[model samples]
Target: MQGTILLTGATGFVGGAILKRLHLEKKRSVVAVVRDSSKVILENVPKVCIEQFDGSTQWEQRLDGLDVVIHAAARVHVMNDVEDDPLAAFRNVNVEGTLNLARQAAAAGVRRFIFISSIKVNGEGTAPGSAYVADDVPAPMDPYGVSKMEAELGLRQLSLITTMEVVIVRPVLVYGPGVKANFLNMMRWLDKGFPLPFGAIHNKRSLVALDNLVDLILTCIDHPAAANQAFLVSDGEDLSTTQLLSRMGKALNAPRRLIPVPSWLLEGGAALLGKKALSQRLCGSLQVDITKTRNLLGWAPPLSVDEALAITAKYFREHH
Candidate 1:
């Protein structure tokens, strides 16, 4: 934690938050690797612009003297992917690009390399009481998940031959202030008092507040036990879709307009409308057990789900 730290994806939500936190903590030698320097707005932190992450990208100069490399940049997963070959596209960035940079970091004598991975590597969903653990046999079901799983495998292999330690953190749905995508859409729906049919959803999902994930990442930056290990992270609290929506309503001061529709009906209707994936996400269980994270690092999520939701809602109201 004392030495210089190099971070990728400085303009991204997770990376931006991490850079801001490092700045506020008065870290003296933090460097942000970005594609566009203009997109990064942090003061005093040096920005190193790398056009892209591929085999030819020169990370040697930028990685010099860095103690830790937090590789947070990647081609994120999208719902309606328009790529000709989605798996190849994902592999180009998430797998090949990741290993390309990691190899350079290890060769540069970097002490540790932390990779931010996704819980999707554990598979799409779980049974009601069964939660995913860090060491579960990987059952990645999509291109993005497969890419992450491959990157993880490559990094672990690299760690075996290199002196640099590798740490992987797999987090479930992360939401907080500046959140976007599905979480933001849900908030917009709640704020507008839109009637939703998730009132009876009993499926539980584990989500991590942005702050909690950052805290765990920072802990991994220096924790001795974190070397060559993978940790599953969450808020340690699971909530049903209905429960989540109700809490979000309270945070936004919006009325709960959810109708108590049965899960079977919703699933059936979605199947007919070709929205089975959407409905499954809303009503299926995707819980992750964070006992490894808690016991190994002695870390607990600093913010509760409600507290984090309130902060997220406040930001949404001010910005949008």
Candidate 2:
């Protein structure tokens, strides 16, 4: 808690929030690793450069005095990757780059290395009543998920024979201020009062707010029990698709006009349009039970879903 912390992906949505939180702390000496220093939106925070996500990048110098390395940088999932071998491409960054950084951090005497993984490692969808836990076996469907799982396995192996402790956090869909992708598109639709056909699609999905995730990462940095452990984190509340849209409408102060369409019809239409993946995300059940995280780390999400959604909505209105 009192030592220097090195953060990667400081320019990303979740990473930006973490960087901002660290800036406000004023207790820990923080250094952000970015591709370009000019793109670092946070002022007064020291930065180092790593131009590419590759194994060849040198990390010892920047990681020298760092007590904790929050490895948030990765080759994020792309809907349509035109790469020759998408799996190999993901492995090059998410797996190879990650292990390289961890190995260097370990050799540099960093005490803890926290890897931010994805819930996709647990699989795509869950049973209606069942929720994912840390103990679940890896069932990564796509290349991105598989790469993250490999990184987790490699880091755990590294922890076994190294002095540095490794902590893996598998977070569900993370949304907050400056959020993009599907969540942002959904918010935009709601803001415009677009009637979505999710009224009858009753599916539960788990999510972590930016603040909650940042708090968990900070807790893992120093918490003795969190060392060499994996945590599945969320807001500890599950929401139906309809409920999520309704909440977004409320946050945006827009009309909640959801058309009551059958789940079968929605899926069928998505399949016809070659949007099966999108449909699964919209109508699938993916929940996580954070009992272990709460029980072990004595941690709870500091923000409720409504409060977090309000913050996201306010930021979107002001910025976009």
Candidate 3:
């Protein structure tokens, strides 16, 4: 924990959060790997440049003397993929690039490699009253999920054959300050006081705040039991879509204006609009059980969902 740590994706949202945390700690010497060093916001952090998805970087030399490597960079999932071979595109970065980085890290005698994986690796969603556990069999539905699963399996194989330790963390939808993508869009919609037809949504979703996810990553960095293990993490509280929007409204000081619509009608409408996937995500249950993570690492999300939401809301008010 006190030695040099090389972190990828420092310019990204989650990675930026992690870098901010590391900056405050000031205990470890952190080097950020990025395409353009000038864009790195965190000063005092050294940087190395590498072309993503190419596997063309000189990693062995770059990784030398580094104690830990936190791999958070990958080809993220695009909601509407335009690539003809989406799986191949994802494999290029998430699988091939990831394994290449790990192989070099292991060869360079790095002590540990922490991989940021997705809950999609577990499956699309969960059944009502059931949640995904750490030991659940991987059933990736999309190309992106498949790529992450492949990288995880390959990293575990490397760990078994090599001396380098590997820790895999699968996090649910992560939200915090500077959050973008669908979560950000949702926040904007709620902030504008747009009425949503999710009042009757009884489905539960497990989400991890950016702070909580960063804490887990830091825990895996030095925890001996974290080696060769995979963890499922969240805020330890599940909320329905209706509840989520209501909280967002509270944070934004907007009225909770939601319309009651049956799940069946919502699904039917989404199907007609070619937004079935979006509907499934908005109206379906997707909970992660973090009991293994809690019992094994003696860890719990320090921030409650509402506390995290408040932080996010404050940031939004100031920025957007």
RMSD of each: 1.0, 1.0, 1.0
Residue-level lDDT for 111 in candidate 3? 95
Question: How far out, in Å, is residue 34 in model 3?
Answer: 0.5
- List runs of model 3 lying over 4 Å from the truth: none
In model 2, the Cα lDDT at residue 174 comes to: 93
* Residue pairs with backbone overlap in model 3: none
TM-score of 2: 0.98
Better of 1 and 3 by lDDT: 1
Off by over 4 Å in 1: none
lDDT of 3: 0.91
Lowest-sum lDDT 10-residue window in model 3: 51-60
User: Candidate 2: which stretches are off by over 4 Å?
Assistant: none
Candidate 3 lDDT over 5-64, as tens digits, reads 999998998888888898899879899888775684677778888765445556758888
In the range 234-303, model 1's lDDT, one tens digit per residue, is 9989999999999999999999999999999999999999998888889999999888889998999999
Clash numbers, per candidate: 0, 0, 0
Whole-structure CA lDDT of model 2: 0.92
Candidates' C-alpha lDDT: 0.92, 0.92, 0.91
